[model samples]
Target: MARLFGTDGVRGEANTAITAELALDLAVAAAHVLGEAGEFAGHRPVAVVGTDGRASGEFLSAAVVAGLASAGVDVLDAGVLPTPAVAFLTADLGADLGVVLSASHNPMPDNGIKFFARGGHKLPDDVEDAIEARMREPWTRPTGAGVGRVRRLEDGGERYVTHLLDVLPHRLDGLHVVVDAANGASSVVSPEAFRRAGARVEVIGASPDGLNINDGVGSTHLEPLRDAVLAHGADLGIAHDGDADRCLAVDHRGEVVDGDQILSVLALALRERGDLRGDTVVATVMSNLGMLRAMDEQGVTVRQTGVGDRYVLEDMLAGGYALGGEQSGHVILLDHATTGDGVLTGLMLAARVAQTGRPLAELAGVMTRLPQVLVNVRGVDKDAVETHERVQADLAAAVDELGSEGRVLLRKSGTEPIVRVMVEAVDQERAQAVADRLADSVRTHLSLTG
Candidate 1:
């Protein structure tokens, strides 16, 4: 059988692949695994739980709570909070584990379950595997007094907002900012954080009715945020995904600022304050060539990993680096957060804008994004993408042709029989042409049906 966990966590369509029974089983198993690992040696195991306010989350959260409590783990139910908030609460409250019921930026009908360890850190692969293995194993049931208790954590959002404010380097005294919450998890706390930080705040995609999240707003959809920023004449706009673990921005000129640009801006800001540890930042292999070039020119080093925030985080931790993130806006400021916190990222970005007296566009201007084109070629033997002779020759030719002014990357999809061909160049036309040629080569040489 395929592994239950993907790059982030176990996710699927609600009530189908991710059902209430599965959530319960996973929770119980996680508690058991952690308990056996001596995490609960001297005290009863405790867990912090939260959700993204999806209608399915109502039932899913209940199932998780039930599982944990029945397994003798006390539960602090933090209702309707972002994924990072749950992580923070887990550490703040001294809980042994944290569970977030969310599908992040997925469509409303999809949902997911992810866990955090004692310090609000994501579980390592070995631990996740152990939990999965223990899910169906027979175990003793806790009796009356031994059963864990559940309590509602009514101040979770407030506590999280306070933490964000404390981590902010500068106050947004005169900035007028617009926030797009994706109508998901950060609907309330995101705006409240900006307002308290002294920014004149306007909001859109904040009225989540459980079904409207990521419908036409949030980071995935920038049209609404751009229009709102232009209409309100805001200094900048911040967009958060469903569970608010990622953040992407829009400048006052109504131009969308991507994660690469955001990272460049933050890298400079942190460097200025000497807070960028070792003057190094971590990024994924898929990061734009522009970001890499900008960092090199600025005397900052960027370490590239595979295509996942977890890999980026792993690299950062190993090197004691202070900044890391993906192109998808999952920025991790290691000094303050154990996981990516969208609200914290927005506040830090705004603080930079306010402190330097430079517009977001000007700060983001440090890097000029090269035109990038990506082509997905399916019905191919994805595993042979690297070894196939003809495909390798075509890729090498494309790379040699692009030379110093551009780059090419061919990656096999982790979950599907597809190969992604990405090319970057000085011009869009050139990038697209190279990417198309490479993709055609992949299809012709590696076709499974052929």
Candidate 2:
């Protein structure tokens, strides 16, 4: 059988691959695994659970609560909140564990379950594997007296908003901001948080009907936000995914400002205030070369990690760095959050605009993004990309042709039978041509049937 956990969590089509049974089993197993680790040895274990605004999340959250309670763990239901909010509340409330039911940027049909250990930290691989292993073990049902209780956390959202407000360096009093909440977890809180921070806010993608989450909205689709920004003549716009753990922005000109530019802007802001720890920022391998060059010019060091926010977090923690994030806008400001907080990120970005009296376009201009092209070649043996002689030779030749002005990266998809071919250069035409040529080579050299 395949492993239940992916890079993020146990995620799949809700009610099918990730059914109620699976959610319950995972929760019971997690309680056992964490309990045995002495996380709940002295006192009764408390679990904080939250979910995005998905219809399926209602059932999943119920299943998780049942499982945790049956295993003698009290459940604090923080309903319809962002994943990061659950993480923060888990730590803030002194809960022993945290559970968030969300599929992030995935469509409405899909859902996931992510667990956080004490202190709001992502579970290590060993802990997750152990939870999986324990799922197959026999259950020890607790009696009525030993069973756990359930409660509601009514002020969880307010607490999170208060935290963001307190951490913000400047209020967005004079800014005109547009917010696209993707009709997901942040729909209610994101707009409210920004408005409370003093920005004149207009919102779209804020009306969710459960099934409409991430449909033609959010960070993945920038057109709606861009048009809204221009139509409203707003200073800028912010978009969040289904779970609101990350954010992407649009300038007043309606130009998209992606994660790379967001990172550059925040890094500079933190550095200016002497708050950038170790003068270093952690980023993923997928970050544009331009971001690194920009950091270098500003006397800031860029620490590159594998393509995941967790990897960036690991590097940041190891070096005591204060800021790190993925190119997809999942930024972690360790000073304020243990995980990425979309509301916090948007507030800080707008605060920068407010403080400097500079438009977001000018702030984002701190890094000039290089033209990038990515091709996904499917129906292939992705693992062979590194060792195949013909593919290696072709890739080497392409790298040589681009010289120091460009680069190529061929990586296997972790969860699919595909290989990603990415090329970046000074010109879009060259990047696309080089990427397509390498993709063709991958298909020819690594096809499974071949």
Candidate 3:
């Protein structure tokens, strides 16, 4: 059978691939698989359940809560919180597991269920496979008082915010900051956390009414945030994705700073403070060449991984690295979070600005981002693109043209019929022209005839 779970979790359009029944069954199965050890002495293993602001999440959350409780697990219903909050509560509240109902940065009509183990860490592949296997078995219905109970886990999110404030290396006093919440999970917690740390705060995309998540806002769309920062004469801006697992920022002049830059800045900061583990930051291959150059100048090492933050985190943990993230804004500070955390990343970035008394734009001068362009080539046998001599030649020529001043990347999408063609150079026009040339080569060499 085909797998329901993806690299991150089981995600799809609401009420379709991710139905309520599936959520229920998966929740019950997880309770059984993760709670089999007489967890909490058979006291009904506690589970933390939360969701983003998606309207579909309302029913999904209830369905998940019901399944776990029916399977004899107590439910800490942490309603409308970020994915990290669920993980944090799962560990802090001593729950057996955590389930977050979100699709991360995906559109509102899309949703998903991502799980965290007792310590707030992502489940290993073996465990996820086990849960998938168990999902096909007969459902267990605990009878009598053995059935679990459900209760709202209020005030728990505040604790997470407090933790974010407590861990800051310096306060953000006198710095005016703008926060774009993406009208998703971090709407409440992120703004409150930033304000508490003493920053003069302005908020955009905070008024989520479910359907508005990731709609022309958040990390994926930075115009509103940039405008807000400029309008308020703010020191900078931070934008959280749908589930607040990641953030990208804008400096005072409304220039965007992605996760690569954030990691670059943070790695240097931590290294100076003697906290950076091995003086390294783990990032995906998608990171810009400018980041690499910046780190190289600082004597910091850049470790490359595949696209996902999970892969980056795996390498970080394996190598005892403290900082890792992706170009798409998922920044994970292993010292503070078990998962990617927009709030934590934002606070830390703000703290750096405060500590140095330098504007975010000045600090961002640590890296000069090369203009890069990504073009999607579709309707081809993507697997053959790399080995085809014509395509390889195109890539080689583009690389040669780029020389030391640029880079090129051709990546096949994991779940789509598309190959992403990316080129970066000293200028945007050169990057776009090179990318267009490569994309044309891919089409000519690999285009499908229907």
Write candidate 1's Cα lDDT for 288-346 as tens digits. 99999999999999999987777888899999999999888999999999988889999
Model 2, span 183-241: residue lDDT tens: 99999999999999999999999888889899999999989999999999999999999
Point out where model 1 deviates above 4 Å: 376-393, 413-419, 441-450
Q: What is candidate 2's local distance difference test score?
A: 0.91
Q: In model 3, which residue pairs have backbone atoms overlapping below 3 Å?
A: none
Model 1 compared with the native: what TM-score? 0.95
lDDT digits (tens) for residues 194-296 of candidate 3: 9999998999999999999999999999999999988998999999999999889999899998888888888888998999988889998889999999899
Q: All candidates' lDDT scores?
A: 0.93, 0.91, 0.89
- Report the lDDT of model 2 for residue 253: 100
What's each prediction's TM-score?
A: 0.95, 0.97, 0.93
Evaluated with lDDT, which candidate comes out highest? 1
Number of clashes recorded per candidate: 0, 0, 0
Best by TM-score: 2
The Cα error of candidate 1 at residue 315, in Å, is 0.9
Model 3: how far residue 321 lies from native, Å: 0.9
Worst window of 10 by summed lDDT in candidate 2: 409-418
